[model samples]
Target: MNANPKILLYILMISALGINTPLSIVGIISQIAEYFNTSIAISGLYVSSFTFTIAICGLFIPVLFSKYNRKRTFVSILTVFAISNIAIIFTKSIYIASFFRILSAIFYPAFISIALTVCEEIAPKGEEQDYITKILLGISIGSIVGLPITTGLGTIFNYQVAMSWIFAINLLSLILIIIFFPKIKGKAKSYEMPFSSLKSKEFLLATIGIMMMPIGASIVYNYQPYFLQVVSHVYTYKLSIFLFIYGLFSIFGTWLGGKLIAKRDKATILIFQLICGGVFVLLYLFANYLIPVLILILIFGILDGMGYNLIQYIESSVIPDSPELANGVFLSILNGGIALGIAIGGFLVDGFGIMSIFIFGALFLLLAFIILYYIIGIMKMPLKYS
Candidate 1:
């Protein structure tokens, strides 16, 4: 198998972009508010607006990029991403910071969708799965890295410093792309618009199944702090430690996912989802003890990393030709799932209490697992959804 090293550059570029922005913005929300002399809710526009833009823009990226040079467009996105990070770090006004954040966010889905398509182009023949797995690992690892970097730069020093660090990460990605990536000639082809593919049962089911698993993840992620507080009662430093441990192990987990995908396909998906779903149930059962809670989280992180890659592989399998459309739609749905998970989990917390979130989170993954099983087993669909 020919290993194309440029794909590594692609992975790095995407991973760095994935890691830097959100963590810095989220980690520093309170600090940004304090610095700008604004309320936390107002400062939080940086995250909320950015997330909103990624999802909305994501839906249209494949179609919009059809008339342009993907590489240049992606690079331009990174340049803006870097500049925005730098701008936010120096800006004193919340409104000014919000402007740059929204600017950067608009390009995030473009970067992600383009990166996935490029990874497919550069893979060595039959080594597509390997390439895809590595790219997914790159993404999962970004989330892992975001925590400690944010904890150190945001919590310890200040939000400005955290933003500066993100500035460096984005700048590095920009530089790497210019140096390592080959000339991106133009759009690959006029992809059948991603929205049009929603008519296929296989495509729709894959989208729903893939999206549902992430909702479980988002529920856990969005509510971890609240749930942990309820569990350990005002714990701070230990929570940080647990997150770091979760992240470190997850980097390894992505590699494990790559290995598993090589050996097994359908079984791997079923088992990974079940274990991830089960972890949430275990988390609830052991919430009273700090050690058990941390252990379950660590397991959750590992499986989460593996599960993301596995599901992406499934989605990619469904639409082998139109990778741009497939990735764009999948990402849009993933964003929707995250939003749904967060919103539903919030309501559950307000009404039924924080512990109820675990039940719902577990069900989300198991439901995903069942969907995967039905599609692959009962329906035996070939995913020949053109």
Candidate 2:
């Protein structure tokens, strides 16, 4: 099968939108707090709201769009996303901005889902992993460019300007999607039911690990800047650089993960990265030296990037029957776990300290490792890769 350049281009555009998310979010939290004269606790709710809605929608999008045309589905969602981005520019009220965010969240899962679907449809037999990785590379690139640009812009200009950049990215995505994405008209193959494959012990354990990685990563990503600036008194520009490096390394990490998983098995790569990631979480929290903190962030970023890809690759490798639907479940649980992590991390920061969030996140990943090891090690489950 030939790789479609148009589809890849569309993925790049949508991935930019994905990248804009965290950058705009972290920047806005501080401004939004000051704008309303509210506490940081209140501003943090925006992150929770975004991820929570994403989790809910990820569970249902595949089923909802099962019979619908893929092109139409994506265009409709992108239209809503465009409107939401434009609305954010004018809406000063927290409730209004948040309402738009919820709207955007409803459609955001398609960004990944559609890309994966396209890749799978076009990939050669036994090359599914490579295709998925390349599609995900769009996400990696988006984060790399989006974080530094939006964060820095937010610091220099107002949050509205930062928001405008996101809107611009979305507008560009809409245009490319409209111009390039082929109208893929087809009916989906109906599955028996979701979570039907959960009976398999290997799937159950792998899913648990898949769920842990995103939630654990988001715990730090969602709130680390606030911790550094508000709690540790780091300067805004300096923090932006740190965040940029984190995201930049994230892309590299994900690319490396694709290569590693292709050469080895997903389980071995996942286990090593998760353990190392957990250890770095602790090191990041205690390191007072800025250099050490930056180093830890780099390490953590690589682990996270690889881990995210690992989850998707593992799910497809394990279940090969319905890759997109399997990914849907993976995304749903992973996102839900992310919301939970943020909610818990936020509460801990409010009650205990910023550092405590890392402790909590590390524990989450560690627990996931224990579950993963038992299935792969004790039960002697087949590795996803054949």
Candidate 3:
């Protein structure tokens, strides 16, 4: 059974839907706060709780159901995600809405873990990254297409309507998965969870290597709207357009990262960190200028975009045979970064200023880059050459 492109598209789209459900609120966080009659600090908890739930699930879901049917699990989880989005519309309070978010989060690892492993499984050996790129492209769509559109809807109608937009996307993904996905029933044999995965010093360093940039990225991400408002004075619909541009360029970055991964995996990642770190610094400098700020956002978005592929590629390479463990840790730490950033950003925004988030993000990235370079230099980890 050769890997079919059409089937791969189905897998990628479905995986994107699973992941993007939580992201539906990206640009609309502030709006959600107003709608829920809460403070921005409290509203920030949505992203934190959502990511933290995924972090917790990422550590365990892979081990618990290593043998389960990947296709069925994918479909089942999307079904739950779809149901949750629909149910969220009926919830009368933030508490109920948050419950649905947490509930949907549990299924995130199921799709992501399955998607990565399946991409590897269905690829024509050694071309797995090519398939992985297709999925990452789908993720980029969330920023470019899904998020902007959903946020736009929120700007126009309300958050409920924005959620309905997500519901629509999830529905499309669910239908496509069942129709086009290959039926690989039954479990994968030879599942292995090496305790050495935790004990490996090099692996831990590499994991932390990519982790810092994401922490910084999330600091900006979770509070971008607030920053844009303070910096460029763009609001609502106009803001979503800039975000769309930010997401659109990220696709190019994804393509670039995919190509570079073929050559200098770790080096390419480190270079991106340095570039993104600088971009974060520029965000602070150019905050007062509209055109320059938007351009910087584009550069930041592209680097951030490349980062998704780089992180997953490195994590999977660390434990090639164990897809769940690899992807599980990938999702865990990545979301852990987002959770931590949002948590800390709440304090920064409330105490310091909106601009402080970017400064903090920049510092985090620079520090991470320094540490990553030292680790790679000392450990002499072979990630493809210069």
Worst 10 residues of 3 by lDDT: 377-386
Across residues 1-386, which tens digit of lDDT does each residue of candidate 3 receive?
44585567556665674457567576688878878888887787874677789888997777665677766877888898888888877676788889989998887876777776777677776777777777777766764676667777888898888888788878887887787776664454636667786668767877877788678888987798788886679997687677677777888888778888877776786787778878878888878888888888888777877888888877776666577778888888888887788778889999998989888998888877877787666767655223
Each model's lDDT comes to: 0.72, 0.68, 0.77
Ranking of models by lDDT: 3, 1, 2
Candidate 2 per-residue C-alpha lDDT over 234-327 given as tens digits, one digit per residue, 9 for 90 to 100: 7766776777777778878777887778777745554664666555565655657666666676787787778766777766656667555666
Top-lDDT candidate index: 3
Q: Please provide, for model 1 over 187-213, each residue's C-alpha lDDT reduced to its tens digit, 9 standing for 90 to 100.
A: 555665654556778878877887888
Residue pair clashes in candidate 1: none
Off by over 4 Å in 3: 2-6, 28-47, 185-192, 233-237, 286-290, 350-355, 384-386
Ranking by TM-score: 1, 3, 2
TM-score of 2: 0.83
How far is 92's C-alpha from truth in model 1 (Å)? 2.9
Q: TM-score of each candidate?
A: 0.89, 0.83, 0.87
Off by over 4 Å in 2: 1-23, 33-42, 124-127, 188-192, 219-234, 281-293, 347-360, 380-384
